[model samples]
Target: MPFIKLEGGKIDKEKKERLISEFTRIASETLGIPEEAFVVLIKENEMDNWGTGGKVLSKILAERGNK
Candidate 1:
């Protein structure tokens, strides 16, 4: 069994579904694990809880006018 843990902020349902499908497919094929045996866990946090370059994601996105 394979366990995949991801910490990506604020993903929509469609993208999350696609990611799970694609990741399962590739992992199953490459690792020779059954699709049903693979586990994928995604933990989403607010942008404020994630940071880069000493700046929180929310602040960075705000400065970039993205959020």
Candidate 2:
């Protein structure tokens, strides 16, 4: 069995469904493994809970003027 973990900001239901489908397809094709044999875990975090280079996501986005 193979496990894939994806973690990042929250995503809408539609995007989540698409991601799952894409992941399954790629895993099955590249690894020659059945979709049922693979496990995928997605974790969503708030801006304050996620950081890069010691700066929170909100701050980063603010710096980029996307906030």
Candidate 3:
């Protein structure tokens, strides 16, 4: 059995769903385990609480036109 924990800033429901599905597919194939034997956890944080290169994720996304 495998437990997957994904940590990131806020994201839409559609993207989250896709991520979970993709992760399950890859993990199941790579580990040769059934998809039902895996557990996936998505942990979201506030923009201010997540950062990269000394800058907050919100600011980076805003500067990039919110992607």
Candidate 4:
């Protein structure tokens, strides 16, 4: 079984579905794994709970000029 975990990001339901579809396609084409054998887990966190360089994620994104 192949397990794919996607964490530390905010994603909508539509995007999540698209990710799953892409993963399945890649696994089947590149890894030769059946879609049924692949498992994907997505975890989302608030900006306050994730950070880098002593700055909160919201702050980091702001500093990088990404809204």
**Distance from true position, residue 27, model 2, in Å?**
0.8
Name the candidate that leads on TM-score.
Answer: 1
For residue 22, give model 3's deviation from the true position in Å: 0.7
Tens-digit lDDT track of model 1 for 1-67: 6898888888999989988999899999998889999898878999999899999999999999998
> Mind giving the per-residue lDDT tens digits that candidate 2 earns over 1-67?
8888889888998998888888988989999989999887789988889788999998999899985
Q: How do these models rank on TM-score, best leading?
A: 1, 2, 4, 3
Model 2 stretches astray by more than 4 angstroms: none
Model 2 superposed RMSD (Cα):
1.2
The TM-scores of all predictions, comma-separated, are 0.88, 0.87, 0.75, 0.84
Q: On residues 2-37, what C-alpha lDDT tens digit does candidate 3 reach at each position?
A: 999899878799999999999999999999999999
lDDT of each: 0.91, 0.87, 0.91, 0.87
**Backbone atom clashes (below 3 Å) for every candidate:** 0, 0, 0, 0
| Model 3 CA lDDT for position 57 | 82
> Model 4: what TM-score?
0.84
- CA lDDT for candidate 4: 0.87
List CA RMSD, all candidates.
1.1, 1.2, 2.1, 1.5
